[model samples]
Each structure stands twice: as C-alpha cells, then as structure tokens.
Target: MDKILETDGERLLVAVRNLLEAKGLVTTAEITERRAITDAANPGQGARMVAKAWTDPAYRVAMLSDGAKAAEALGIPMRGMPPLGVLENTAELHNLVVCTLCSCYPRAVLGYPPFWFKSAAYRARAVRDPRGLLAEWGTHLPEAMKLRVVDSTADYRWMVLPMRPAGTEGWSEEKLASIVREGDMIGVTIPAA
Candidate 1:
C-alpha cells in the first residue's frame, strides 16, 4: 500500500492561489475590485476612533465605557457584529488581543487581523501564559506592568491600538501608523525604534 502525505494549510492556500494565477484569472482589476468590496464592507472607521482616543482624554473614556456608541459617533458602523471594545496599552498594564475559539476581528476599525493572530499558537498561549507568550514575540513588559489578556469571542471582539511612544509628539497620523506594527496592535510588542 502507498502512504499518503499531508501538507500544511498555508501550503494548500498557496497552491490554490498559484492555480488561480496560472489561468490568468487573477488580474490586478480583480484583486482591486475584491479589495474595494472588502474595504467598503469593513472600512477603516475604527482606526479613526483609536486616533481620536489617543488625542482626547474624554473620548478615550467614552471608548472604554461605550465602544459601540463611541465607534458609531466616529461614523463607524458596527452592524451584524458584537460591539467591539478597544483596549489601549498603558505603561502599567500591557493589553494583548486574541480570539480563542474563532477569528472574530474588528474589521471596521483595524482593517483585518493578521493571520498569526488567528493561529492556534497565539490563541492557546495567549490565554495560558500571556507574559511568556509575549516575550516570545519580542515584547518584554516591565515587571510592574500587569498583563491583561483579552479574549475575542462571539459576543465581543477586541483590538489593541497601543499608545504612541513618547518621542513622537510632533509625528503625523500617517507617521504614527507606520510604527503601529501588527504585533504592537496585537499587544505582543511595544512601539519602539
């Protein structure tokens, strides 16, 4: 009997993409159109809320108290999904985001959650020992700072829009966004040069 070999899921996805591209079916227009639809469906309205909160203390309070209302106030639509809660990273307590069961992301605000965020390693270890897991991802929070691991579930999904690092007071939003890496947004790393 011949033995069957299994391949990784990522390899399988790459194979599918390659197959589609081989047939000249995946054009730039097709990609752009699909992206446009996705963007329309899940806009960057949430990111605006994060920017506002970073600048305004009152808005930050509002976001922490009532995320749905705050997001709506900022023109972000939160329909057909649970009201997302935003966790701001502070010097005292670092916030980490994860979806333990499924990938329930805040698409309207943060665009799309990264693939690694949906990985079993991140999901499982985030809940089990967040500090150690974060360390593996190159984030070393101070001993005094408490680690608050948030779970993204059906009823509510969360995202961490970390505070802008100190030395960037005069930086523009576009410049700020440049430093907001995937890991920083996920709370596994801090914003630093």
Candidate 2:
C-alpha cells in the first residue's frame, strides 16, 4: 500500500482489506485505485473552483447548473464518483450539507469528513435545527434568512458555494482561495476576505 498504515485504525482497515482481497470479494488493485482517487482530491481543488466561480460569472452559471462539469473544466477528476452539486449561498439563503444516513461526504473535493461531520449529533441536528447547529458553529445567520440543509448521499455529493467575502474586490484567484477553507465548503464557516 502506498499509504503507511501507522495508526491502529489504519492497520485495522488494512487487515480488513487484506481479508477481503484474500477471499476474492475484492482486490488489492481495486483498493489502491480507490485510495488513489480519494487521495488525489483535496480542499485546494474545491477552493480553486469556488474562487473561479466568484470571479467569473460564466463559470458561476455552469457551477450552479452542473457542478461535476464545472469541476471537470478545472481538471478535477470525477470518474467513478457521484455527481457533484454546488449549492450557492446567497443573502436570503444559507446552505448546509449533511449526510444523515452516513458520512457520504465529497471527499474528492473536501478531503476527509471532519470528526464532527460524521458525528450522530451533527447528522441529526443539521436536519432538525440547522440554525441552532450553525449558531453553535459560529455561523449565526439572520433569523429572516432561509437555511437549506441538503443531504449528501451515495449517489450525489453536495458542497457549498460560499458567498465571496467583502473587501476582496481585486484579489487574485489564489488569494481568494487561500481564505476558503474546507469548513467553508462544508458550510460550517465562511471564508474571510
């Protein structure tokens, strides 16, 4: 394996994979390929896409209409992955993404799911009282703004297109992306200008 199974949890996963491969239920090549796909994706890709959307109106339209194609346009691979859906955060609407069934995160775009993201509390409350949850996360939205919680599932993955922060009018795309963290893509926080 290219990844060192240093942690106990990682060693356990290796053991499981080995057993599955030994039984012919799966293969080492398959596991490695999947890992490669997941490993190649990181928050940087998502940030670049978001920054581009913020700077280019045409790309923003494509991003809002077809996130997968938008990602591909920026050379982010989407093969064998679920469709990527970009949810725009506007003045009247704040968007949140969660996977109630399990941690069906957009790992290809946002890397691993955060510890809190996979927690049962976050999964439940995000769908139940998202405003309260966002408040606790330090994203206190105005009471009048509508909060929409979209579910990330096995077939479709969702990510937030956070509103561009103020005071960055002439900033470069790289500068803009620098402030767009993984949490911002997940809608738990907003990027600073």
Give lDDT for model 2.
0.89
Model 2 over residues 51-146: C-alpha lDDT tens digits?
999999999999999888999899988878788889999999888999999998887688888899999999999999898898887889898988
In TM-score terms, which candidate is top?
A: 2
What digit string (tens of lDDT, one per residue) describes model 1 on residues 1-193? 1332266668876786778888887865787786885577432455466667767789889998878788888776666657778787776878888889987777766666778877888888899988889878777788888889888776776777677678878666555656665566668777763
TM-score of each predicted structure versus truth? 0.70, 0.86
Prediction 1 global C-alpha lDDT: 0.73
Task: Kindly report which residue pairs in candidate 2 clash with one another.
Answer: none
Candidate 1 similarity to native, TM-score: 0.70
lDDT of each: 0.73, 0.89
